[model samples]
Target: MEIKDWITLVVPIIATFLTALIGFGVTLNKIKREFKYTIKSYLYQDIKKLYRDLYVCLEKVILDPMLAFEDRYIDELLNFKPDIYLFSSKNLIYCYRDFGTYLFNINEAFKHYKIEIDYEDYDYDDNGNVVGVNFGEDEVQEYQFKVSTYKEENCPSSKELKEKVENILDNLKKELNMV
Candidate 1:
């Protein structure tokens, strides 16, 4: 083939190759951005839910000291501990650590005042076998289980802890751009 003919063929081939490469690059970039956005959205949703639950539990404890002894409130804190450790950002992690420490101190201070109530029950099968035990209204027993009064000065006020939690949550909201 003549030089001019060869040039014509080679230039079109190069142009087509360049067009395909640019198209592929643009598509990859778009996918990357979409993936990032999806991950951020998921993390934001999870963090928001967990934060709200923890805050509510803390608020209950602050509003009513007796509620602090409830098993459910303690369970909420325990459940949140691992998730916060795993998924929280650096600042949130620090806040979680501080709040956890404060909660531990409060619990320790209240240890003497802990109370336990026991209920007696019997569950029998047709053959009179004790298959299970039910703690119901049939029999009830109450005891001053581990009851001891602590000096008021020994325990930290729940209000202070609540304030710290609120501050942390506010900072978290800002960090997550939810505010």
Candidate 2:
């Protein structure tokens, strides 16, 4: 065959190959973006729920220590930690670490102080009658002291945790181009 004939045959083959390659690349990139978006969306939702639940748990601890401590509050918090390590940024991981450390300190305080709750007591009416059973002074004072300590010493940590959660969410939004 002549050079021209050879050129024409090779040119179409090359063009078709190039076109297919480009299309595959584009499709691959689109898939990657979508996959990334889906994973990040789930991570964002989990983190948001964790943050809100942490706040609720903290509030519950303050308002009703007996009910709060009796439940699986800490276990619920633990459920989100592995996700932080797997999908979150380093900063977010560090923030979570700080929060965890704060929790550990609180737990240690409880253990060191030997804070125990006795689920027994009396209810005094306006007329000073024992209407029902409830927590006595020691238990009440212990909880009051815990509330005071949390308010004084732990509020800043809680605020820091809130800021960290907000920062992480902002970072995630930026990554997803939602910002």
Best by TM-score: 1
Using lDDT as the measure, which candidate wins? Answer: 1
Model 2 bad stretches (over 4 Å): 64-179
Which residue pairs overlap in candidate 1's backbone?
none
Candidate 2, residues 1-179, lDDT tens digits: the string is 99999999999999999999999999999999999999978987776666555455545444543322222655655676776587667876676576556555655554444333322345668998768866667767976776566445533344544564565556555544567
Cα error, residue 114 of model 1, in Å, equals: 5.1
Tens-place lDDT digits, model 1, residues 42-110: 988888888788778667767766544445666677788888778777787788778767666666556
Please state every model's RMSD to the true fold in angstroms: 8.1, 9.7
Q: Once superposed on the true structure, which residue ranges of model 1 sit more than 4 Å away at CA?
A: 112-158
lDDT of each: 0.69, 0.61
Error of 1 at 142 (Å): 11
